[model samples]
Target: MIVRPALCTIVLTLVTVAVHAKTPVATGTGGAVATISEQASQSALAILDRGGNAIDAAVAAAATLGVTDPFSCGIGGGGFMVVYLAKEKRVITIDHRETAPASFTPSSFTANGKELDFDTTVASGLSVGVPGTVRGWHEALQRYGTMSFAQVLAPAIRVAGDGFTVNDNFTRMVTENTAKFSRFPATAALYLEDGKAIPAGTLLRNPDMAKAYRALATGGVRAFYEGPLAQAIVDAVNRPATKAGSAVMGGAMTLADLANYEARLRPAVRTTYRGYELYGMPLPGSGGVAVGEALNILEGFELGKLPRAQAEHLYLEASRLAFADRNAYLADPEYVEAPVAGLLSKDYAAKRRALIDGRKAPTASVAAGDPYAFQRDASVPLRPLPAKGKLLREGAHTTHLTVADKEGNIVAYTFTIESWGGSGIVVPGYGFLLNNELTDFDFTGPHPNVPEAGKRPRSSMAPTIALRDGKPAFTVGSPGGATIITTVLQTIVNHVDFGMPMDDAIAAPRLSQRNGATTDVEPGFAGTAQAHALARYGHRWSSAPEEIGAANAIVFNPDGTVTAVSERRRHGIGSALVQNKAH
Candidate 1:
């Protein structure tokens, strides 16, 4: 494997060693505040202290997240943001999801009617979706933020230009995933040097990315999509090596695709469970419908009265049904048919709920309540399947941030490059990683997720905002791909159903059901019998590290103070700042 020196190795090591040696001191609180990554939270709190609104704080935090958490998110990737504008009493969903190239088609990765290996299909240029993070942020600022894009992006540019101390989590991720970076020359040159990975506590800078951002600040989103940056991306994709093999590495993502990409605003999917109204991303994102269906299905059971094991069974059953429907019917509504109403309907949920046996696990392909006319097309033509295991096929490592201002405005944003540092391909002179999100699409033809021109790839991004008694009460989201919906669903349950505090709710152990696999309980789970019982149902149990998905949340208490918490498992540190409160 090729190893390269990270620009920040030494500084990162020293800083990490020093920080670990000392106890962390609690900081920040009351009227107006922000919390995210340790440093990003501080930056947002500063913005709040300066009289900036929630939008301002969120923008600041997001920009900071791009710098300190580069592996998960950056301007090069795309995402979704749910904004609650208190003044207008409007909750808008920004559908900034990545889109497919105009030349993309269902057979893009197929070889003689067979599906290619998942990794081989989605990791290269063929899998890249149209990026929208920049456009989403820009539109958000233009609509509700008090500060300009330049002002909000200042912190990120400063961090990238002046350099920042790398943290332990980032250092470890870089070291472990170094092989991915070596595949692309530009990526290797930017992230590594002299054949060694950057170590912990290194001081790293990204002048090129900063310069690109500087131009963006001056010229808006167009500067990146229509200017020299766009040309660089096109050139890089078409480089000889990018097309040297039969693999679909380089194709037609021309300057036009970049220039034409736009971030659209849509209505948030709204559903009521118990007494609270839940809102999440819709259509292109199955997270909202899937989570809503799970919640609706579990509502049929008395989770509050059941034993912990029983509750786990109920959760697993609901997850199975939701996921089955997801694979069968969910896709970009702009390109395919999705059973949104039928999937989320209470009647369908109840029928699916009845399939759970409680005493034992169902077989791998147990039937869930099907939506109207949902056919099991066993005769569908087979496409070449990629030769990768589920573990390797799973995409993750993204950043989530929740922000709320005194006026009741809120923003929940989730961003990513669609894998650890994306495909490890960095565009020369851009200094940011490009998303490998195209892998999210099925390379096999006849699958609902097959790629198509102008199609938006399905995403699990569920940036959400909820209103209670007609006002913003909670803002939450996570960054775990397929697990994202599960994490957010459980968090909401812990807070709304169990009445846990925001911190405790987010801190709760999370379990995920991915592609028929049930991940065992994470840290802080109080039950093992449930895990053991799950094994009896033909379910394979595996332990996931604490670094799964980091969930961040902020809740508006009845008294008006905001409680913000970040997941500790991912080494997440959150801050609470109150406006006009004595320090």
Candidate 2:
């Protein structure tokens, strides 16, 4: 391991403080802890209290979130679920990510040898993908849950039919996407009122969505992807837009794509960090591998003993290195043969570590490194070409939830519609939106992550769980566009390496370095002592407000309790469910 004495010592100091940090202690006697939205969480806990497993609770909350936070997630989008089955004592990942339409082609986003305007592609129907959320929920429930689909989906069904009171997050997102919503009259009519964004506390109901949920509960996954609902989705996907919208040729979505969509059970990537084993999602999504790579590099330093600012300097360096590889090498494993093993290998991390100079920060963008040295017979690493232009940020428009039941089973899920309001097109009578997941593809490029039929787009949503001493210890995740990997990485380091309590870790100030000279940090960061600490190391910095992520987390206590934290940065709720003795 590459050791620096000063680093280890400072990290030890941080560890001492972390032990005393004031995050509440929760007990399994409370039944379950759901850290995101209470309405959704309470529903999940009720399932567990009624003798359902973690998977059932997760399915319940995930469905409820679609009703409560429509802009960020719903049946219209897709997501990943990482589960630790208590009975099986093993972790597994579900790949419910959206895929490109079968009709999509390489030149779809190009005209006359130039890329089309990204905004145009996003605003048009061409950006919609084959959604996989329903398939994932059905799979999870069938494989691990003990509750009926109707039981798990009941809460969301009621909320959609009865209406939910809008919160700050709901109002804020609607205001921000007014322009996109206005462009599509169907979407404009749902959330916008009197030609203006809906205000907070408005009670909104979607009876159409309730009927859609009823169909799924009655007919299972096939109801959404195989028949009337399926035809409705197709019609919505291929709907005509106004003249201003593109009549793009490759925009037509096929019934086969939707009918054939499958939620595969993929291998969950694993890595050892500070004696704890961290588990995260694998290929088609970059969250797990990138965070693992960054963690491996930082593993060499004694994070808790170092001054916060100095430790942050090391974090920035590690993140920069990992992101370089993420941007260059990561792609759909099925389509692009990503070298997953080599990217997470300790030896490769050591080689990548050599590029970090303690005396200076990286000036220019760091390029991808050759990890093939560690892989045997693996596909050659995809060399990163110069970026055609800066890609637009996907927007912090996703939702994440975690559930730890009394049975010790744990579930971490992250889902998204890709951007604020997604394609801004509702499925007419269904009253739910469709994801602009195609926007996640390279608009026009020869990169490894270019658009391809049936390929899952590279995602930054990191739904993560960790085990210590061979038992589930903590779970955390976030929604921050490209900053997600770093956001999740920092939380793990904050709790595991620096000793912060789970609540404090989730709420801590954050910094992100995406292979650039400037590191972005949240406003009022406490690590100001080392704010300029990396200036001598050649790193420049800037302070921004809530530009990183909103991470929700749960830390399992040795005493059989847990600590839950809903990110205060947004409209989040963290509650430990106490089963009524009467129940």
Candidate 3:
């Protein structure tokens, strides 16, 4: 077995408070925020309290996450944001996924006539991609926000300077990445104390990160992509700050790559499920297409009328089918011709759904289904299927935040740096980790997701906003690599088909089956009656139990109030707060 570095390790710190207790659910009338950290949720709630719209509050919370939950996400990474515009009566999306540098090639991860070991590339600068988080945030604020970059970034800046109390999560992440972090002087200086992980409850200050935020506040996006900050980033990637004799591989990133970076406003992926319109991120992120396909497959069944176990069996089967197509066809649209319209077509879903046996799981592995016949543009020929590519490993990390304002505007955003400490190389003086996102590409070629110059790697971030009868229904998202699709899909199913409250839906146990031979079931679901009933249907579970995803959601009630729900068990419980609620 290949033993890899702990890529999913993440730290969760509390802002100003010495002790923290996460409130996983909150309900109020005006506005609400839910995230993995208390400080981030509070930061967003404060913005809403100050009369800022959901877009403004989302930016504030995301920025604050950089300070309190550094290992999960920050300005060093990129993400996708789905926003609901109450006045415009439309949903829009921002695609800020990191792109490979101009120097990259299809064979970039290859070495000595073969693909390099996955772990070897993980912590090296060779895995770094051009970051887009800052640009994405700037675009969101400039186009849809009521506040300036400085205004939204104030909370993060203050938290970074004031210092936060480290918790067990913080110490655990440091301990897991000690070997990698120790190799870099800059990374070690902050996370490690004399080559050891800092103990829990210790007050950790990051003046350097505060300085970084201040620079962006004054210099704008240009400061991050062109000025001294850009230079520092390029230097860090090209010549990583490694200790002598460590022999870490540096990247080929250049100033031109950084300067050329820009976040885009892409059309959201739209589909209807049970009369509700679902909107999600477009290409370069597979969440929407995959989730939509699975939902389409499930729509044929009356899950509400079926036995709970039977409904769950179908859900798992649908996930397996959707993932087969996702892995086979989805990639950066600029590099590949993915038949997205066909993939999400109801006709195609009916055809795929026919393969599921209600009484049993597929005894053999499922193959990708053909969707070209349902393509809107029938003239486009089907591309020849290549041999299956190596599964690009993704750590179950990253972060998701949801916010809604009194205006009815809502934002569901998910962002990441791709691993615990990213490439585990901290930029000298910048106090942020560069993303190892390029590793998301399939290492070998002759495939859709192969590495190429300026190509954006496909992501599983499904930030979703659903609407019923032209009004907001709910907005949901999660952070868990490939399982993100299943998590979001299941949560929606739990609430819509099974008639659970939003909080109960999120708190429910999860099962992730991504075309694998055995489904990965959470411990909470492993020994239950549902598991046994499913087992009779030939459904096998992974030997080891795994928590699937940390998902957050907001439910819009018929009464016009919003209920924000966070994970009650995952990521040490999450924080959910509302603008008018005193709790």
Candidate 4:
């Protein structure tokens, strides 16, 4: 492996620190622990101390995420988790991805037989998908946790009822995205008051959400999907205020959709690269396949021995190959031929890697080899949409949590409300944010991602775990919409290939190959010289701040200590419990 003596030594030194901000934390070599939002992390750690396992800790953290990080993720949204079982040496994938409502159709967002503007289609009820967060958490807990539902959810209830001080990040996001919040009354009521965004340290409370969590704790997953909460959701969606105006399409979510929503347990897509086995979420998400494809292509090149420029070339080229395939053939496998296996194959990546020239970056439309040429005929055509400037949703706020217990069990989970505070649509009695995830799909028709009855929308959330010799080695994930996969991939490279410590790996300057050739260099690295160096390769650098993605990770040391790292770009922090006696 390519290693810098001083850099590697520094990484090792940081990993040895008993405590550091934004780094992962652990206690006993094999004791239970959890990492998530600062508020939720404490709660999850409490669960672990109370005899809970990784699964129990995850549930606790997920519930707290619904409360504290509601702007980005909550029970109203859907997500996935990758769970590693120590005893079985098996990695299981939980697909709680949001599905299209029963009333949703290909033309749901069209008016006068033409596609509506992205804002109109994305914000209204018509944009909501069947939420899966509640069901998904319940499934993971029931199958793997030692604690009961009430125990896991109690912390979230307490947080919502007692309230917590709004952090700086929350305040800044609310101020910046106030316009979108003002458009919806319920949303504005929760986040904004008197026409001004709530300042930091403001005591934010949602007793209604507390009540809903109480019901969930008492009634289990069914309580939310089939019980009183479900009825409230129906009522909220049917309310006149919830309907889309004359300028946009509206929706009514049937009770049947909620009742029938089932979170599936599938096999994680695992691929071997340079002796390490990488595990990531499968189809409904293009993340795993895309990450694998990019890594595979880079594997053909001797990046471990290359200088910075050559390494950048390989990174950029591989990213191009992966992104091209993602746009072309990746989708929900149930609805289309995704070519999951073929796309990640070594042979295919080798051929695609051969197209890269070490000297220059190619244009955006440059074609990469079709790795799945054999099944090209079976691939479903992606629905077409009008050429609009890049559209990003408000409340891009989301959180990621990573945990690895002493038993070798690892959990990488991501949850989101799919916009800041999720359309600001909180059911009067429900007390939680409702997801705008349906906006993730193209509202226009003739695309593979077009809304359809019971179809799951394509998601960019990729919660992942990595294993070495059948044991938990790394657990990590991020909250950057389409940038999730690229961020996770870069972190893994920083940890495994470059041997960077958890903190530096997460904090290092990073770039994403997801949307065109976006180079998100950190502030100091974007100097005139670096800009000129990038320009030589035809790279047009945008002045966008490198707040690309927020990531959290934990590395399991063979000696029993756990190293955790949280992203510095946003207000994320990482902590661990080390065994002082042992050290």
**What tens digits encode model 2's per-residue C-alpha lDDT throughout 495-543?**
8888888777877777788876577777665356555565656666664
Residues 22-78, model 3: lDDT tens digits:
899888889899999898998898888888999999999999988888887988889
Best by TM-score: 3
For each candidate in the order shown, give its overall lDDT on alpha carbons: 0.70, 0.77, 0.88, 0.71
How much is 211 displaced in model 1, in angstroms? Answer: 0.6
TM-scores for candidates 1 onward, in order: 0.88, 0.90, 0.95, 0.89
- Number of backbone-clashing residue pairs for each candidate, in the order shown: 40, 17, 0, 23
Give the Å shift of residue 504 in candidate 3.
1.1
Model 4, span 483-518: residue lDDT tens: 787788887776766778767887777666544645
Give lDDT: candidate 3, residue 582.
37
Q: Model 1 segments beyond 4 Å from truth? A: 1-36, 121-123, 240-248, 373-392, 515-517, 520-530, 533-539, 543-546, 572-583
User: Which stretches of candidate 4 lie above 4 Å from their native place?
Assistant: 1-28, 32-36, 240-249, 373-396, 515-525, 528-532, 572-583
How good is model 2 by TM-score? 0.90
Candidate 4: C-alpha lDDT: 0.71
lDDT-better candidate, 2 vs 4: 2
Of candidates 4 and 3, the better by TM-score: 3
Q: Which has the greatest lDDT?
A: 3
Please list the residue runs of candidate 2 whose C-alpha ends up more than 4 Å from where it truly belongs after superposition.
1-30, 240-250, 378-392, 524-538, 542-544, 572-583
